[model samples]
Target: MYLKCGLLEDAEKFFGEIPLGNVVSWIAMITGYGKHGLGKEAVNSFNKMQSENIKPDAVYLAVLTACSHSGLLEESQEILLRLCCDSMVKPQVEHFSCMVDVLGRSGWVQEAKNIIECMPIRPNAGI
Candidate 1:
């Protein structure tokens, strides 16, 4: 399978062939791109899903977390900001976790700490 073999291209190809991709399929494709260190590709997948009328769920957000791992500041920040403004997706710990992880890794530890401080749900210990 794509996951077992880490064949992102093949995975995406097959995904594109799917007639009715549900939320789960969308998440899988995005996660596949992310796992392959393709943050922009993951975001593109998210955009494609949206363009095709797929509503992103929390799992989609998780896939987008690859931006943090990949250190894609602008793209990640844009998505986070959009999510915050949309009102459909509330900010959750995992969301904050991705942001914090990105910020901290990018040498913006102070800003990351501030974000954690300002979060509605206080970050769990050991963050």
Candidate 2:
């Protein structure tokens, strides 16, 4: 509610008050924070979600988007690796796109090209 309205603090405060904050709640906060360019807050919320034993599913695309927007390149790379190796989460075209965007934004165009070349699935138009 507040998030969509650009009221980040209010949204975060309301979110924190939820007694049984589920993945949906967390996603709302993360997505809102990301959209607002509050990348660190989004990442922190994600860490807290993990601490609560919430396993991120495909919806973590929001987090990657946040990281990409903020140029959190190293963190994004680590997340990409973890999504592949540790969590067994399938990387979608959106995920790869986020990485490429992050790399390109951070002036690592060569790296982005490398990732596109090495994609397990054929690089889509989005990438």
Q: Give candidate 1 misplaced runs (Cα > 4 Å).
A: none
Q: Give the worst 10-residue stretch by lDDT in candidate 2.
A: 80-89
lDDT of candidate 2 over 1-127, digit per residue (tens): 8999999879978987999988888889988888889888888888888789887885478888999988888878877776777444777888888999999999999999998998887887778
Model 1: per-residue lDDT, tens digit, 1-127? 6954898768878987998999988788777677778888888877777798777766547554878867888778888877777666777778878888889889999999998998777788655
Task: Evaluate residue 2 in candidate 2 and report its C-alpha lDDT on the 0 to 100 scale.
Answer: 100
Q: Model 2: how far is 1 from its true place, Å?
A: 1.5
Candidate number with greatest TM-score: 2
Please provide TM-scores, in order, for all candidate models, with all chains considered together.
0.90, 0.93
